[model samples]
Target: MAKLTTRGLRIDSGGTGGGPVTIAAEDVAGALGMGRLKPQAVLVGRATFCDDNRAQLELAKWVQQELHRRCRRNGWKTDYCEGLAQLCVFELVHPLRCVHCLGRGQLWLQVPERRGERIVLVERWRTCPRCKGSGRKRLTVRDRAAVAQIGKSQFADVWAERADAMLSDLYGLQDDVLRHLWKQFADEAA
Candidate 1:
């Protein structure tokens, strides 16, 4: 098992073999050949990267569980569940979202008629500043509200329902295929 701590979070990343086992640092890319490594290491807000071995992942799980238990014992009602959902979904599925245009792909380059100078064929499209070229504004068209509900957990049921369809179509993976792979894969690095 591998163990590490960063920003006060502990990670225990080893486990039974054939499943995901958090390997040493140099082992992660090599481990890619063995199998996919799920990002089992949970993290706090905006935290990225973690120890990916059995010991480190285990400790991470333990810390989070303890925090939740303590919160529950004292009736703090921490929103860990929602946070976790957001973390997992964003971590797992963000790349898929990147493929989408987010309603903004390009804009026509401003062309000027100088009447004599050779007509410079400007590049056809320029990136949108609003969406940062991701084409998706943080605001929804209907609600005109910021896109705080993007991650997951906070998603409305209707959105989730639509998202399932989108996921099925966009990923080109059937629900069963994802479940099968997810059940088997434990070493997704990216």
Candidate 2:
């Protein structure tokens, strides 16, 4: 599926076989039933200046009007419009997990079975019936040296750095529009 981050609204559609293509906000918004939301709304802040919310709304309204205009021009399937609108809302809603990992970072790891021939699998230790001596489980580690290597989240600072990097992208143009419009508007206006 094509996952488009349109103004922080992720709209997934029938992708082009390859990966999803990221297009301009207008294109994605239009595809996802944002015909009522204007590309102008997206571009206006980025391109021009409007201090008040009403100006931005006007721009968005203009964009929606344009989307509808294009629908008529292109003879698009307006029937799918509702579904696309739902996609718009879905995009705005906070995603539970990262689309990349689907929440879990590491893929399922298959533990290697111990065998008689392997040098590491000497008689001293047989298959770790629990982890199969793979040391896969964080708590279970037959290797004393390896066990010491595991590091905890030690400090909130370390965790904070990871939090900053690991979490889904927290902010975007549209996000600012919704939250910090004055700053964004000024930034864009400047």
Candidate 3:
């Protein structure tokens, strides 16, 4: 048997190379000073990057649920769930278009043209102020409010800010996962 100490309490791990040991949820709850811990779902199978991503999403979903439950005691707790949902959905469904340029990638500016004895306004093209040269930008509070429900519209500003940071992290995680998957596939092919 192997002994492990946690907070001055020693735990026995049966023996070395004992495969995997399963602990009761009640035991974990007792350790954490909780009344009880009941698992809602358990997913067991071959793990892959895709599975890892799914598990992470599931965890996020659970966190949102817990936040909502806690909102009964404190109203501010609900914002966390709303913010997380908005951030996740912003990338999945809401594609951004520069409001200033109207997705044209450029702005039409009116310039004064001197022609002989008369001055006339002529339309000139300039890069979009909102999105620079790219027609697309990240979803903004206004953009979200345009299509969001009355309830969702209230948290648009807050969600947009958090969504920006979350989106960048999500993109990086996706890129890493794709690279890993590609390398694994290439290795198997060779």
The best candidate by lDDT is: 3
Which lDDT values do the candidates have, in the order given? 0.36, 0.33, 0.44
If scored against the real structure, what TM-score would every candidate get?
A: 0.26, 0.24, 0.35
lDDT of 2 by residue, 43-63 (tens): 443322222355444544444
Q: lDDT by residue for model 1 over 28-92, one digit each (tens)?
A: 33333333323332222112223235433353354445546655776754555333333233332
RMSD per model, one decimal:
15.9, 20.8, 19.4
Q: What is residue 131's positional error in candidate 1, in angstroms?
A: 0.5
> Which prediction has more favorable lDDT, 1 or 2?
1
Question: Against the correct fold, how does model 2 do in TM-score?
Answer: 0.24
Task: Give the lDDT ranking, best first.
Answer: 3, 1, 2
- Candidate 2, residue 63: the lDDT equals 40
How much RMSD separates candidate 2 from the native structure? 20.8
Per-residue accuracy of model 3 over 54-161 as CA lDDT, tens digit each: 554554565356546655555553545654544444443334667778766788899899999999999999888777855666655555544333245655544445
TM-score of predicted model 3? 0.35
